[model samples]
Target: MTAIDIRDVSLEYGEGSGARLILSDISLTVRSGEFLSVIGPSGCGKTTLLRLIAGLVTPTRGAILCGDRKVDRPSRDRAIVFQDYGRALLPWRKIWSNVALPLEGGNIQGAALRERAIELLKVMRLEAVADHYPDQLSGGMQQRVQIARSLAQEPKIWLMDEPFGALDAITRQQLQDEVARLAAERNMTVVFITHDLEEAIYLGDRVVVLGAHPGRVVEEISVDLPKPRDQLTTREDPRFLAHRHHLFGLLQGH
Candidate 1:
């Protein structure tokens, strides 16, 4: 089943005088329970494409369909996790409250909401800092909380824009593994945007490459590496290295 379908979508920033075309005739489909990563040059409209899917921005042309329905506005069915965790979270609200904010006044409340929030926190291994403020936690911890909050929505589709972009190498690797595990376990469809080739290959079932200067799909590579993957196994796999090198060549326009 197609969870997301973007058909000939194009987006422009402004009209006539200051018009800047971002994406041109972009089309893609994400299958249910598939992990797809988009890798592109800086200004390749990768984030713009994600925004279109999330309904945060509408395309000047073409249409987006989520399942059988067309997406006209933001829905709880899709959740976004951005690179900036601080901006995503509320400073005044504690961790649990931040996670529970989306459920406010919408059926779930009191003990049930609290229980769900704590359960999500536990999944991210953040239960110890449940009552802490955003500022009190490290950068990695804040991002984990943001992940928990995004998951709390029980979204079938996750749109992540470099969710671990700011973390140190070790922390980033840890979270990448966690995200892969969680996405697979939940049977969620994910559209992840990142510039890291290895990370893309590690988490994605297929990697889509976009070219800059009027961004378009340059290539789409299938990752045939086996599942239940660890960083060591992925790194050691000959097929993984072959895909990585192929993607690198594509990125370099080789």
Candidate 2:
């Protein structure tokens, strides 16, 4: 069940000698309901790849297919969660209202929208702050709200770009587990981007390492750990350490 097929993709900015190539000959298939984490050094075009799948940008060459359809523009089927939750949410709207924003455009209205928002808020453990504004919440709570809002879209694929990079270590781990749980319970397909090797290995079913200088897949390793990953046990597992070592070496050009 391939959810996304990116075929021989290449992205270039500008034209002629001034052209800057970002991604070269990139190809990969993302299975439905699979959790894929992408890690790379700075300027690897990791976020660009995500934006490409989100239909926010087009590859200068090759095509990207979502299911049987070719991706040309952004659709509700794909939802993106950015690192900057403050900018992502509308401060004017309440936490619940922000979560329900997507549903308002559709046929759902009134109590139905509120009910849906509350449901997702509870999933994110954000029920306590349902009526509060984004400004009133902590960074972690704000990020949770953003996650809840993304869920409100009920997207087939979730594209998260360094979603917890700015949070404290403790909060990051908590949200990592939360996201893993939600994705599993909802049977979601997620494309998570991060610079943290341990974070990637901890949450991903498969970790895709991208190389810089025209980003392309360097290595893709499957995580053999058990589901409902334990932060303590999973990270301390020999297999987890092995993956961390391998990916670290790959990134370091060892």
TM-score of each: 0.97, 0.98
Which 10 successive residues of model 1 have the least lDDT summed? 100-109
Model 2 Cα lDDT, one tens digit per residue, 99-185: 999888798888988988999899888988899999999999999999999998989999999999999999999999999998998
lDDT value for model 2: 0.95
lDDT of 1 by residue, 1-102 (tens): 999999999889989989988999998999999999999999999998998999999999999999998988999999999989989899999998899888
lDDT of each: 0.92, 0.95
**In candidate 2, which residue pairs clash?**
none
Per-prediction backbone clash count = 0, 0
- Candidate 1 global TM-score: 0.97
- Candidate 1, pairs of clashing residues: none
